[model samples]
Target: MSGVDLGVFARCFPAQAPEPLGRAIADAGFSSVQLNLSAIGLPTIPDAQALADIDLVAVRRDLEAPGLRIWGLSGSYNLAHPDQERAREQTEDAARLIRRAPELGVVAVTLCTGSRNPDDMWRAHPDNDTAEAWADLLRNLGPLFDAAEEADVFLAVEPEPGNVISGTDAAVRLLDELGERASRIGFILDPANLVGETGPDEYETVLRDAFDRLGSRAICVHAKDVVTWDERIAGAAGLDFDLVRALHAALPHPVPVVVQDADPANLAAVRALVLGDA
Candidate 1:
């Protein structure tokens, strides 16, 4: 239906074991997933105990049993949390997952650059733009970057408006600051994040600019629509789906457009919307 591959967040499906989970995703007409361990009733970044319990071989077999590919793993943790101790613990867990990703034939792990807000990583805080927040982000990401390089995996950072790496410019700045470690970093482009108070007339321009700057560095893409600052949905009435399709087609290479924020009940509509068949 499209040149680009279509995927969905595994968390968008019901939580169950891997074998049945795979069948559910495949039965929903998707051949790809951005796997979140939580979808199968585990932490997003599993501990050694949980990790050891996983059967990598069976996981791969079952998820692919119905021809579903694991495009990437969800390794999100708060890199800039005000509580340094808690943040470090989370990073360590995520690093473990990043190091273990290759065993599942996955090469990328998605991350949130995170926020200064202690309770909510996704919520914005006045301090998020402070120098200290940036420093915390860099400090927290160091170990994960090391794990990624060691395992030959890419750390795909999503630029959320509410987070420290707030936009394309900030994302570019992070790469610059990483110096040698920048090679291990990449991006996950979600057009919704780039649109804030932007008028419909400027959606294409805004999206195009983002693509021009970050498209080369993108390892994944998220297809979702923004109805408000905090609300995201698939098949959103206000977002321009054709613009999403056109810009996706213009990408330098193919990347999976993972449908994020879709309700399980809206699976068919989200599929059609992302596939350009709506």
Candidate 2:
């Protein structure tokens, strides 16, 4: 664990102000965080006036003052919206976020691969698997990748169960499509998101295979655990800690493991579990 960083999603402390949020995360024993820019009063797309008006340096100070490192910025948006105009807006916003990341001292900007459901980016729809949906994803991401390359920041793509790029194979295929631009893209491996109603006997095998497929490209890991398709929880979620440890060990480089989708009060316990101290 010498090289690995442990973090929590900054949104977990929704009720607190930026300074208090950072302090709370540090108090829970996390040294890093995946920050939502909005929480710090930074617009995802800062207009010329906003660029001048927003004091990002001060924002960084607020987080760092509490001993929390900003590992990445959450720039999640609907990249695969059925409406082309709406999707274009989302991509442009992402480009803006990408351009501002380096100044914030962030290593990557995490994103949703998106869904065909125009109303809900996380909800699954049949059209998500269609050629048109894939094309839309490619179309939106192409310019976004160019922006990432110019910004020199990595884009960490997360694979949720219900999105255009929902699985390890689809994610790898998208990376392959990007070719050289793929260098700017990384993976956020959330083992719970990868699990899909596998029986008790097959859970470990399923998880190990996913790690084998995606670990090398993973830059961050989400620390939520899943018991079944519908049952996700903090801590181990009934999965073996030994298996999780092994998977982390297999990564080519140590990356931040971020705790997500858990109650704020359980953060300390989650941190301990993720660090193998619980």
Candidate 3:
């Protein structure tokens, strides 16, 4: 992690507005942030009206004022929700974000492949592996891909164990299906999400496999530890940061190592662990 760029999830800071939040992240020694519009009281996937309310210039000024910049925009709506209409709505919202990503100076928009459990997109369901779920994902994803193409932004999908794109194989399949449009898609690697219910014994193997298959296309890497599927900051749980750092260092191109699941109190400790400065 020594030569890697370090960032943090902006929402990890408690500030309700952009300026203070940027200050908080900079103070913690991070130079970039994966921003969620929710950090400024707007929906993550805002509608046209809400999107109109955003002041991209103000956001950029506020964040850069504190030496922090927006690296990625969180666009994580459920891409495969059982309800097609609800999923479509989320997709349209994400499309809006993708179109405006350049204005915010963000290079990518992050996504979740989603789940069939109507209540929570993060909860796993048997149907998540079914053909219909795959169809739902593709259907919802098409428009977002178009938006990415038109806006020249990368759609970085994060593989969650509970979602349709649950592992490296699924991720690979999706990329293959994208064909030429595959160039517009990249990945966000968070080793903790790959761990799922598995214990730390699977950490290195899982991390290596994921990188071997997806590392070259990685646009962002999440720094969090796993405790039997639970997520925490680096070194606070079971994940092996040494292996994580090695794989990150081996990436063909540099990507931000964005720290997640950390709050102000422990942010400094996580930063040190991520940078191998601890």
Candidate 4:
């Protein structure tokens, strides 16, 4: 964890406004944050008026005042929605967020590879593994890549259990297919997302393989202690800290390992575990 910077998702502090949330995170001992636009009342796809109304200078000042760094913005949306119109809308929103990321002092934007489930992007669907699904995903990604290139920002895609790009191999394949455009794309490596309720030995093997395959391309890490496929906590889900350290070591450069999907009451415990105090 020497080179890893610990952070939390801004949405974790739902009780506080954006600026106060930054202060709360810093006071809680985190050094960085991944912002959710909705936390600040900005629509997922903000128009020119909304964008103009955002006081980036004040936002930056407020966050920095408490020693908090803005690592990335969460622009996660379903790229493989069953509804073509909805997918297009989400993609356009992603593009808008990417274009405006720099002005907000964000280095990257997190995204979901998406599922065929029209209702929930994080839910699994049988069609997620089909060739047609892959094609649809690629087609949708093209415009986002164009937007990333134009904005000069990195797009971090997380490979979840039920998404079209579910595991390490699929993620690597998607990256390869993108080819030159892959430079603007990066991975948000979440160990918990790649494993479920399994034996410690099998979990270790799968997690290690994931780092071996995609660690080099990761721009950020998500720290969550997953017990079951759907049950995730803040920290210490029986995963060895040594493996976490090794994963961080494998990265080409230091990046934020942000904690997510945990309850507000568990944030302190999560922070302690991430900082090696537990």
Please tell me which predicted candidate would have the highest lDDT against the true structure.
3
- Model 3, stretches more than 4 Å misplaced? 228-237
- Writing each residue's lDDT as its tens digit, candidate 2 over 216-240 gives 8889888877643124333225666
Model 2 TM-score on a 0 to 1 scale: 0.90
Q: Whole-model lDDT for model 3 versus the true structure?
A: 0.85
Cα lDDT tens digits for candidate 4, 1-278: 65468888887777545668777888877899888877666665566667667776677777667888899987788888888788887787677768777777888877888889988999999999999889988998888888888878898888898799888889999988988988988888888787754567788888888887887888888887665212323332466656786777777777788988755677876666765775
| Candidate 1 vs candidate 3, TM-score winner | 3
The CA lDDT of each predicted structure is: 0.84, 0.78, 0.85, 0.78
Give lDDT tens digits, candidate 1, residues 1-278.
36567788999888899999989888888878899989988888888788888877678788878988998998988899999899998888888888888877785988998998888889889999999999999988889888998889889998888899888889889888888889988889899888755787887888888888988888888888776312323323567778777777777888888888876688887778667776
Q: Estimate, for each residue in 1-278, the C-alpha lDDT of model 3 and write its tens digit.
A: 55567999988877578888788788888889999888877788889898888887788788868888799998998888878998888788889889989888898988888999998888899999999999889888899989998889999988899999998889999999879888998899998897777767777888899998999899999987764212344324577778888898898999899988888888777787767776
Give per-model TM-scores: 0.94, 0.90, 0.94, 0.91
Which pairs in model 1 have colliding backbones? Answer: none
Residue 88 in model 1: lDDT: 90
Query: Top model by TM-score, which number?
Result: 3
Error of 4 at 31 (Å): 0.5
lDDT of predicted model 1: 0.84
Ranking by TM-score: 3, 1, 4, 2
- Badly placed stretches (over 4 Å) of model 2 are 1-3, 41-52, 227-237
